[model samples]
Target: MKAKVFKYKSDGNTVVASYMELEPYAKNVYLSLSRKNEDGNEDDDCFHVVCRIENVYFSSGQYSRRFLKGEDCREEAATYCRNWIADTLQSAERGAFVNLISVRVFEALGLDTTSLVQAREEYKRIQEQKRREQKEKEAEERRVQEEQHQWLLNEQKRKFLDGERITGEMFLEITGRDGFDIHIRTKGTFNRHVRGIDRNGTVSFRKIKGCRTPDFTGCHKAVSAYLAFITEKEGK
Candidate 1:
C-alpha cells in the first residue's frame, strides 16, 4: 500500500514541495518521503525516503534515490517505504529490534504478531531447559565425588584393621598428632626402637612394650601399622 502524498511549504515558505507521510504503524515511529533537493527542484536526483523510530533514523539510501524524478516518484517512494517498514517489522520478529518494537505497534498496524510471540517463547523454553540440564550435571558430579570419598575411607579402614605393613612416612603422619611424642632410638642403625607416647602418656608398641627390632626399617613399618590400628579403633 502507498502512503498518502501531500504538499507543504519549506524554508520559511519560500519553497514549495510535496512529501508522502505514512500512517503511524508503531508507537513513536514515523515514515516520510521527500524530494532530495536543496530548492525543491523537479530535476532532483531522486526521492528521499526515511523512517524514524524514537531517536533512530533508517534511510532508504541510494536504492530509493534511483527512482525516476517525475510524478511517478511519489508512488515509487511510497512502495519502497512500505517495503522498508516490512523489513523493520521482520527484524523485530527475529528479536533484532525486540526492545524497540512493542505488541501495541503490531496492533496499531493491524498486523498479526503470533510468529514473534512464538519465537520469544521458544527462546525462553530453550534457556530454561539448558539451566535444568546444567543443574542435573552438577548434581551428578557431586554424587560421584561423595561416593569416591566414601570408598577411599572404607579402603583406609580395611588396611588399618588388617595390620598391613606401612611406610616410615605413614608412621610419622600418625605420630604427628597434637600432644603425641615419637621416640626414635639407634638412629640410622640396624637396632632401632620406634614408639610413640599418646596424649594420655601411654606408650605405643607393636605387640610388646618398647617394641624393638634388629632391622630399623622393619621396626618403623611395624610401629606404623600398630599406630594406625590404634587410631582407627579410637576413632570408632
Candidate 2:
C-alpha cells in the first residue's frame, strides 16, 4: 500500500509522521517523529494531522507469505519508523529545522513530507486550538478551587456567629437537648456534614471526622455536643 505522511510545522522544527494500513491483516500503523528544536524559535503555529490511508494487499504465494509476521507487521513497521526518525536526527547536521530531516528517511518509508506543507499548516491550527481549550479548562478548575477555599473560610466564621456570638461549644449547648449535645460525623458524603445533629451523642470522639468545608451547623452541633458532654462529666 502507498503510505501517507502527515507533517506538522513548528517554530524551529516540524514533525513528519507516517500513517498506513496494510492488508490482508488490515492493521493500522503510526510512525511519529520527535525532533528537538536547536534554533530556539518561538512557535506560533500548531495543528493536528488527519489523513486517509490507501489499502495494501499482499499476493498469496510462498515468497510473499514467507516474510510476513502476521499481527506483528504493524509493530515492526512502527519500530523501524521510530528508529529511523531518531537515528536520522542524531546523524543530521545541526542547522535549520527543515535541514534536520533527512530525505533518506522519507525515501525509506516511501513517503514525502515536503509535499504536505499545506496540510501541515491546517494540522498546526487544530493542535493550537486544542491547546487553548485545555488551558481554559485548567484555569476554570483553579478558579473554582480558589472560590471554594474562600467559601470555607467564610463558613468557618459564620458558624461562630448567632447574634449572641456562640463558640463551638455554646451552639451545641442551647441547641442540644435531653442532656445530650448534637454530634456530627462525615465520610465525604453529603457535601456538608450529615444534615443534622445526632443528639444521642453516642459516637466515639475518634470517629468524628471533617473535611475541607464541613457543614457549618453540623460542625457546631458536633463540637457543642462533645464540649457539653465534657462539661457534665466534669460536674460543672
RMSD in Å for all candidates: 18.0, 17.4
Cα lDDT for residue 57, candidate 2 = 18
Model 1 agreement with the true structure over 1-236: per-residue lDDT tens digits = 24322222443222222345543433333344444566655455343344443323343333233344346655655565556546756765665533213343443456687765665666677778999999999999999998886665555445544664333333344434323444444223312233432222233434555654334543444455555656775799
Model 1 scores worst on lDDT over the 10 consecutive residues at 185-194
Model 2, runs deviating above 4 Å: 1-68, 71-115, 163-204, 207-236
State the lDDT of candidate 2 residue by residue for 1-236, as single tens digits: 44544443455355454453322332334322232234543231211212223332111112123233356754554454445445444433232232323442344456655533333455567778999999999999999998886665455435533222333333333334324534344223222333433334322122255635433444544555555665576685
Can you give the TM-score per candidate against the true fold?
0.33, 0.29
Q: After superposition, how far is residue 120 of candidate 1 from its true place, in Å?
A: 0.8
Q: Candidate 1 clashing pairs?
A: none
lDDT of 2 at 126: 71
Q: Judged by TM-score, which candidate is best?
A: 1
Top candidate by lDDT:
1
lDDT of 1 at 136: 100
